[model samples]
Target: MDSAFFSMIFRMKYITRWGLMRSSYPETLSEHSMDTAVLAHALACIGASRLDKPVDPMKAAVFALFHDAGEIITGDMPTPIKYHDPQITEAYKRIEAEANRTLFSMLPDDLKPYYEPVFHPAKEDEAYWQYVKAADKLSALIKCIEEEKSGNSEFKDAKAQLLSMLSSFDLPEVQVFMQEFLPAFSKTLDEQSRE
Candidate 1:
């Protein structure tokens, strides 16, 4: 009898196209998760040090790593398509919830309890959640930066909306990063940020 060994699966992506990190353009789920985890760690440390709000950097990183594990089933939905309206937003959430269910189900039903904490994170750990959300935003922002630098303004609107969303969120350290560090993102391309 074969056991359900947790091994990575190399499957073909059908409908979903485009992936993370333009440097490695058309990256994969595996690649995106790796970047998200590492970036989450760095952002958590920045938040703790500069904002005086300490976070469990390691746990936050883990959260980021698994944040899109659900995508293994649902596939990456482009932001424009995902957020076109409240109906679409709700539909996407439903898709995510189902993917989350599928991931835990991959474990022995009896052993699923152990993975719960990591998969369905607690909002009670506010700082960790903040890092997860910030890391998500940052990854998209980096993608946007790369697009703009490539002379493709396709992501310009997304960059602006994401920056606006980040602005209204009361995360002081993120706010500071946007003000000071973000401009450098564009200047690195020999151009100033459009916003």
Candidate 2:
């Protein structure tokens, strides 16, 4: 089989994030996925280590890595437009499902099983998927912070809105992460180095 299919997935690197906003720094889907994976891992670890939950950081990390793989085909839709209406959201989900299916088809039959679980997990993984969702929001929040750090006021409202959305989740792990790590994003590099 030709390796052309893999190239399509790698094209995620060219998809810019925050397409609707004036960003101080351009971010790519590939970059965001990696950040989300790391954040998901940390959130999962926090849940397991401190919250007495049996969360698997590695699983969460892997899930987060491909959480937006569908976006490679659909392009990164702005969150506001993506969630503004119930109908639109539902339609977009269907589009994403189709995209995932297309992505899965790219791999050889022998390798499909391994990739499927990453893009589409079993029902039992629903609980853990929450952590991936939370990490996605946290990653956005971090992006807001980064924009603010760049002296760009465009993200000020976004930062507040993201914080509100995250707070509404009220997940113990998210709360813990916000308390212990989120504040650090606001600090200077020197301050972080000292700590």
lDDT of 1 by residue, 24-56 (tens): 355566666666787678777777777677577
Per-model TM-score on C-alpha atoms = 0.77, 0.96
How many backbone clashes are present in model 2? 0
Off by over 4 Å in 1: 1-5, 8-24, 109-114, 179-184, 187-195
TM-score of 1: 0.77
Off by over 4 Å in 2: none
Q: Worst 10-residue stretch by lDDT in candidate 2?
A: 1-10
Q: What is the C-alpha RMSD of each candidate to the true structure, in Å?
A: 4.9, 1.2
Which candidate number has the best TM-score?
2
Candidate 2 residues 1-195, lDDT tens each?
764457887888999999889998899999999999999999899988998887789999989989999888999989889999999999999999999888888888888877878777899888678988999999999999989988998988888998998999857889989999999999999999999
- Judge candidate 1 at residue 153 and give its lDDT: 69
In candidate 1, position 8 carries an lDDT of 24
